[model samples]
Target: MRGFRRGLHRRSLYHRSLHLPPSPDAAHAQLLALHESGDANAAARFLREKTAAGSIFPGFLSSVVIDRACKSGDLRGALLILATMLHSGTPPPNQHAFASLIDALSKSTRLADAARALELMRDAGIHPDVVTFTVMIRGFCKNRMMERAWEIFQEMIKSNRCQPDCFLYGVLIDGYCKELRMDRALELLREMRVERRIQPDVVIYNSIVDGLCRSNRFLEAWKFLDETMVLQGCSPTVVTYTSLIRGACKAKKMKLAVRIWNAMLERKIQPTIVSYSVIIDGLSKAGRVYDAYRVVREMETLGCELNVVIYTTLIDGLCKSGFLDDAYALYRIMKRSGAFPNQRTYATLIDTFCRNDRTETALGLFDHIRDYCPLDVAMYTAVVSGLCRERRLDDARALFREMRLAGVSADTHAYNVLLHGAFRSERPEEAFRILEELGDDPGCVANLLTYNTVIAGCCLESGMVLFYEMRQRGIAPDFATYSALIDRLLGSGEIGRAFDLCEEMLASGLSPPSGVLGRVVARLCWSRRGDLAAKVIEMAMAVDDTASFSLPWDDEDGAAQDEDSQGEELGSIKDGATQEEPVP
Candidate 1:
């Protein structure tokens, strides 16, 4: 296996490039040594070349190599070994080697290749055994190729060399069940009993029950478990009861779930952790927290310790009911009882605590949990957002840095949170640093919200540069994007450019904020640029008739003087934005 992996990395196509013995027989010996020493690639190529040259070798050695290659997932290598055996023709390729080849091909979902290999085996006058058919049926069933699987089964029956075993029938039944064809699955069950006189076991019945439950045929599923399995003398396993219990939970039939649990116990079947988890989760989600506690007590009676899922589910129920104190107490109990909290466990308490104005408590809990499990991105992001909300920038920054030290990478949302917090705290340089840091992070990609945060926080010139970069990256700017740019433009006395953006915004099927629009045209009329102002109102009236507000162009009401003392410079700026000027 190691040699095969090495050969794959070498990029060489043939054994000629490899160091080997000169004589073909000696070369075969070296190949065997490589095969034994774990060099699959070189060994495979040597066999292929020897087979191509018709160099004689033992068929048993070829079979040994073929089986190992297939076992190691080297299908091409296995085929080469088979070819070498066929070419030598001393003891000829047997059914076992072909069966192994077919099994490997089927597992790889190369159904066509498997079929061809089966044909080759038959043409060589070697027939397939029960093991061969079983593997083929299992492969087809696994891939949901029931049609081809049925064909193979029928062919096997006609051959009459071996009778179909219970396992083979189980595969076919399971396949139909997974496909949700319960009618066909039922037919097979009947055939297994009436035609073959083979009694169905727990596994076969479990598949049918699961299929019926999944199809919402609860009554029929119960009938099979209660009547059919009992009559056939097959007892229901933990998995059998769990499927029905899970189905009841999904349907919100808590009464039925509990009844199924009791019935399983009546049969002296001990419920697994999964069975308990399913019941606990169902009860918790249904707002039956106290009843869920009863189930926990039952678990205690059996000396079954609670897991993270059980604790987390109950804690979530308590938290949802606004019982924060009880939730925290349960969290402490879980930690003390050897059930380590997962991300969901910590995140639930932290988020609820943060949301309910208990930020300090959430941070304390987070600080404690960090020593147990390496903090994930979600937990770190939640705490950072909460810290930012409380304006604790220093603590948030320390935690952000600690994320990297803990070998956890900050995602884009975390970066955006810090960027927003920096700006909200009036630290623009720190915000820029965050943006630059995001740029260096190959794992994180900035989304539209990130760009909006940066652009909203930056100066007009820098914001414009960043906006241009945003569009160049193919992140389409929304109304918020244009609104931010235009608002900055208007505030900076760049009314002409702001109006241009307003046109772009309208042209892109976006209605700029009415308040921003009115401000833009009003400033244009105030600047004595009546013609430009008129054009802006004309376009505005097209999308929204109310946007063409009546301008005081006549000055009959004694309006103030024009604000454009530097009309020529304003015109120059209007014609083209210059590098020296900070045009909005």
Candidate 2:
């Protein structure tokens, strides 16, 4: 430690007897002046050079060194300076100095260093005050070290040096509740009330109820909010109600959420925008658009300013609940009411319209909103998807160009949508070109779905090239990739290649369509290659033991029996594969 070496240096300087000030008062006064001058290093050096070692130095002066070391961005240096003074039997360092050091170390996430500082504080004969203990406890809790925080709390009580206050209790309780350990949180709350006569406040009550509700203990949470906290004269705040309403909505109990909302009103407690947002989202998701409408109207009645989220959420609900016309009307109302709509607001309206096969309406809405809010990829992607669904490829392409010309880059999903449209419309070459252009555009990150589209859109040759590139890029092929390529190979009479793909598909933990492998097995058996037939059939049979999973296209039951019976069935199958009824 620098402090240890510095201590040795100070001891050596003690015997040197350098020229000095006439009195310790003059020396101390000079030291204080240098300390306040903000050149802490010079002060420390002056202290080491002039001050007599093994003498009773003032603790406050040493503490000034500690503070300057901490402020100078040298934490270990600060701790070392404190250690050197304590070891030298200097006057006890001030509690405020220790508290400051602890706060710095704890906040920097240097918990171990902070703990060492605590031990040094004790060695200096200074018991930690409430502020010091609270800082340590808060640090441990903030780092999610609940166990250590509990240990610190127990240590505080055991020391009898400081008592835990409401703020301290709140910190630990909040930590436990956030970790979803409601049991520990409640136990502490009960102790604070019964053992210490500390009345739990609304913030504390809100935490427990929020924790319990999020834990899906809806009955327990509601009982606590309505009975336990209320009877104790601890009123629920808007934050408290918002939690319960959100919890109720998550539990799909829309009626209970509404009840909480109404209960808040009856108490003359004003609900905030967040409170309205939670219930509105819940009611709209439950297909009760009109109920959500009532809440929105209530906001208007109370002169509460409507934001885009409230409007978008309500409009989405209206669209989802089959009140599309109402959704459009609300959009109109939102605009006329002077609340500027964001891209999300327009996207909701346009997306819902497109999803409902109202592409023309969606396009109209898109054009209308363009002059107001800037266009985004989601807005264009939605309409592109809708147009592609309607097989309006030319219009979709035109919009795609317009999107880039407007300085908005198309995302991966947007490119995937356009490629899929092209493939569906039998424009394979166009799809390939689009995929090539997608690769050239660094902004796009093609996922597994993107590759699957390319594979399904191409011939075997181009598909094989992409499949290799896909593997080199570390994208694993899925059933769709194998299905498309294997179908193409099979149709072109590439039996060997098709069989290898089937084996690969099976090895990849995906079942090749039973008919594809079964056809190969039948053909091999027809050719009297019983070994290959048995090998293929064995893999199929391992995957399909139940009758429901049997090869219903032909008689595949005989292969499910023992070896001898299987051979007999195969021989029969071979015989049935005559010229009139050739093997599929």
Each candidate's clash count: 2, 0
What is the per-residue lDDT of model 1 for residues 184-219, given as tens digits with 9 covering 90 to 100? 999999998899998788899999999998888765
- Please provide TM-scores, in order, for all candidate models, with all chains considered together: 0.48, 0.44
Q: Write the per-residue lDDT of candidate 2 for residues 333-352, one digit (tens) a residue.
A: 88898876788888887888
For model 1 the local lDDT of residue 278 reads 85
Q: How well does candidate 1 match the true structure in TM-score terms? A: 0.48
Give lDDT for model 2: 0.77
Model 2 lowest lDDT segment of ten: 565-574
lDDT of 1 at 236: 76
Query: Which residue pairs in candidate 1 collide?
Result: 3-39, 4-40
**Where does candidate 2 stray beyond 4 Å?**
1-93, 273-277, 280-584
Q: Quantify how close model 2 is to the true structure by its C-alpha RMSD in Å.
A: 19.3
Q: Pick by lDDT: which candidate is best?
A: 1
